[model samples]
Target: MNVELRQVHDSDLPVFYRQMNDPESLRMAAFTPKEPADRDAFDAHWAKIRSSDAVVRTVLADGDVVGNAAVYGVPGEREVTYWVDRAYWGKGIATAALRALVTEVPERPLYARAASDNAGSLRVLEKCGFRTVATASGYANARGAEIEETVLLLEG
Candidate 1:
């Protein structure tokens, strides 16, 4: 699979919403919005990000949208995040896409977080040179409970 990252287009929101709503994906991505099914909220959130200075991109695999990735937050403390279709999980898409994203935005150190149990995501970050700097707990909307999360940092 040829994984590539490109600017977020106007048409990608719906695909992102659907991918985010997948029951299995949500369970795996525990730290999600309060209401993943709220289209209004979803749209509003996307609008905000797309309009912000964030480096948001649509992850394309061989010309098809398979997921989304981005680096956002305040300078010097920005964070990285990505979501791949469940079907595409473990296919190296996330790792490739994230590597591309960091290459595009070389202003690290970039930070990332993943549910502690999400070994796949942690591995992706690690492969891209991110190191676990800390572990924290946060309320997970999808799981409806607080859970452990790992914090990682990538330094140039």
Candidate 2:
């Protein structure tokens, strides 16, 4: 599959919001709850991403938005997060998007975390050069249970 990263635009907000609010997306992302209580928060969040040098890319496959990947937090030390549409799962979209994001940022010692039970996400992180360094017990509202979180890091 052909995969490319593009800056998210105002025109993409609706689709972006929809994908973000998807039940499956929330579950995979370990979101605390299913509530669209505030729009301003979402607005402010995207605004910062748009104005900052930090790279946030929308994954496109054959002209469709399949997922998103981003590097956030301070430079040199960054956190990576991504989620792909459940419908398109198992197609290497996350792997491709992550590889592209890493190339675009070139930041060292990036970090990522996934619920330990999320084998798919763990695999994606591992495939992209992140190594498990630690694990922590935490409440994952999306999973509706306390789970182990695996912390992974990629050093330049």
Candidate 3:
């Protein structure tokens, strides 16, 4: 599948919300659920991203939304996070999206975190030039348990 990263548009929220709330996607992402995300939440989320200087991109595969990837935080020091639809897992879309985000930002020392149990995510980070920097325990709402998170960093 051909994948490319582009700026997120308001029209993309429905697709974004669906992928984000998918059981498998949330499980891998370690997101803490408060309530079912509504259009308002999506609006606020996208608004924050749009108004911020951080680089946020949507991964489109064959004209369909496959994932969302972004670098956010203070300007020079940024954290990267991405979530791909469960159906698209293991298809190299995450790697491609990550590579594109990194290339676009070209900022030094990008940070990423993944649940230690998530080998696929860790592998993606490793493939994208991130080296494990630390590991810590945290609560994953998606997993509903305390889990170890491996922190990784990529330096320009």
Candidate whose TM-score is highest: 1
- Compose the digit string of candidate 3's lDDT tens values, residues 120-146: 999999999999999999988888888
Model 3: lDDT equals 0.85
Cα-based TM-score, every candidate = 0.98, 0.88, 0.92
Q: When superposed on Cα atoms, how far off is each prediction in RMSD? A: 0.6, 2.0, 1.5
List the global CA lDDT of all models. Answer: 0.94, 0.82, 0.85
Count the clashes in each prediction. Answer: 0, 0, 0
Which candidate ranks first by lDDT, i.e. highest?
1
Give residue 37's error in model 1 in angstroms: 0.3
lDDT tens readout by residue for model 2, 79-155 = 99887878778998889989989888887989999988788999999999999999998888777878889999999
Task: Name the lDDT of candidate 2.
Answer: 0.82
Candidate 1, 70-142: lDDT as tens digits: 9999999999999999999988999999999999999978999999999999999999999999999999999
In model 2, where do residues sit more than 4 Å from their true spots?
32-37
For model 3, the stretches where C-alpha displacement exceeds 4 angstroms are 36-39
